[model samples]
Target chain A: MKRGWIIGGAAVIVAVFAWLLFGGLQKNVVFFLTPKELLAKGTDGVGVPVRLGGQVKPGSVKWNAQTLDLRFIVTDGAREVPVHSTGAPPQMFRDGMGVVVEGRFGTAGVFEATGLMVKHSNEYRPPKPGEEAHEKYKTLIQQSSQ
Target chain B: MKPEGQLNSSSDRLRDPSAARPPRTSIWLAFVSIGAVIVAQTYAILTSPAEGDMGHLQKIMYVHVPAAWMTFLSFFVVFAFSVRYLWQRRENDDLLAASAAEVGATFNGLTLMLGMIWGRPAWGVWWVWDARLTSTLVLFLIFVGYLALRAFTDDTQQKARWSAAVGAIGALNVPIVYMSVKWWRTLHQPPSSPATLDPRYTMGLRLNAIALLLVMIYFIRKRYEIARLERATEHMAEAAAMGGK
Candidate 1:
């Protein structure tokens, strides 16, 4: 009976630790913000690490191979913001794709990128005939109001 | 309880003559220490200074670092037990090593999962094949292989000797995994405690790590004791079968 108590007690302790470690500790606190949120934060260079999330604006990227400095523009459909970064581009870095750059706005009102992360959207795919995402959005809206 | 069961006596259980000694009190100490560790870790996470950079998300470091540290510590036990079993050919030591390997594998697996969870927000990717991450992955797989081998091998002697040999070889990777971040350019940062760590997080990390270490040792000891009991039960069953024949 004593041995059973010891084993049972140990098992319970193990289970509690497991629950705390795996269940509580393992769950991440995600604070994702859309481009509108970034705009609302006001683009003054505050020297704080805030993420600027948006798609790279079409035909707004310029690369300087000599210094490896790159300049681009990001857009949230409502506004456009210029960004600058200096680093080896990640393998997936490209144009017209979702990105989340970690840094603050520069003194010149440009979004300075200290670190870059490419966001892979699940909805992104090759354009199909009448399969536009906006069409799905419209269809859902029309069905919901009915 | 009095040691009444004759067939399950420690003396009869040992196949080798020199394989007879009382279990160490270190196992009990190891258990008490783990309880202390869990408490200390909780305290650190709650009261420790928030990092200037990461804020409250830094609290995850308390749990993450300790689990990773214990993974390494448990594997060191596996290595020691493996060497002892190989040298002395003791069934008890082999059992201890197997138990450690199983527990170490469990913790290592947890470390990776927790790491990925932390990494996703911090590094913005779920996983990358960096030095520290890849080597830890290898360590996890090796111990998992150790556990798999133990499950399949029924013959006690064969299992002991073979598993010991594999365990000894696999133990070589622990140090390599620890050093991989330094040796290679990796996205994963190097050791965060007692090394080049931020001053704010150092003491908190150390206290939490000590507590986590204690907890891990306790779990491994309990597992080893259960394994020994199972072995004893198996021995009794075999003896009963032999007597009926």
Candidate 2:
């Protein structure tokens, strides 16, 4: 009888613990905020350390070699945020690529990113026949080396 | 003093029959699995075309993914044996659980290291406290705690009972770790499957997983044998001490 009680007690404890954990996680587990979510925050989202995740808006990428200034628009379908970061973006970074940039939104409206990371999809494929991989990035790589 | 002399004689008597006969299957498995791993890795590297973006760095998946899968597999073994030990009150089950925990911990460590090596170039950082990574680290620590509890305890029955509980509870984290990416907005990608992966890379991934599975089996079997021998020796020593008294 006592053994049964002990087992039952353990089960109850584990259940309660799991409930608390998952319940708490539901509210607090936003690892990065989408641009739409961040835009909804309005002033509250500005001037705070945050990770903003979205795709680099196509045709919105601007890079300055002399200043190492990278400017891009990150859009999550409904909303977009302009991002400005110093230093080289990852090798895989390109227009229309998914990305997460870490920093705060400046009062001037641009996200002043201190760190930039590219997010790749799970797909893996070699360059198609008669096509070259890394062709577009060859100049970027050489410029970075220089 | 008298018990010491009796202990040696008792252990010798117990060991003679088994010691003379080597574990031939385990030895053969060790060689076969090691060879298979080498062949699988070589084939994976040479045949799989370079990924479009990451190039050859994607080949690390052959090792990293298999190690992670084996880690989960080993922990599942520990969980099964632990529950069996609790139900049956069998000493062999306890020993088997411990052996699996040891092997699981090794694979867990490998998974973390290989993930870091992949992450540095791919994620631009060595570590991240994202949901998936943190949960995996937590899983590794839980088993480490389980192993430590076994080591610190002196009473065999108490040690087995305590570790069984720990092993069972720790294993509950495996699913959470596996689902963390899906459950949270994390930088880590969702779980990879045949459907998710391109067809070209599927064969290499499957081959590596099979090879590593063989290696994991060999490790668990060899470790279980050692654990059983250690327990047998302990039993002989205790029985000899009682006889001397």
- Candidate 1 DockQ score? 0.03
For each candidate, give the TM-score of chain B: 0.85, 0.90
Expressed as tens digits, the lDDT of each residue in A60-146 for candidate 2 is: 988877778889999999999999998877777888877989999888989999999877677778888887675334566677667
Best-fitting candidate, measured by DockQ? 2
In the range B1-96, model 1's lDDT, one tens digit per residue, is 433455555436454434333344465677578667767777776665543323355677777778888888888989899888867887889988
Candidate 2 — what's its lDDT?
0.85
The residue-by-residue lDDT of candidate 1 on A1-146, one tens digit each, is 73365347546756764563357533321233345666666744345676676778878877665566878888888877788988654434556766767787765768788877665442212223454322222333343345
The 10-residue segment with the lowest total lDDT in model 2 chain B: B17-26
Q: Against the unseen true structure, what C-alpha lDDT does each candidate score?
A: 0.69, 0.85
lDDT of 2 by residue, B1-245 (tens): 43365456656656687652324345889898999899999988988998877788899999999999999999999999998888889887998899999999999999999999888777677787888899999999999999999999999999998898889878888888888888888888887777767777888899999999999999998988888778777776787677756
Q: Which candidate number would show the highest lDDT if scored against the true structure?
A: 2
How does residue B104 of candidate 1 score in lDDT? Answer: 86
Alpha carbon lDDT at A126, candidate 1: 26
Model 1 per-residue lDDT at B201: 59
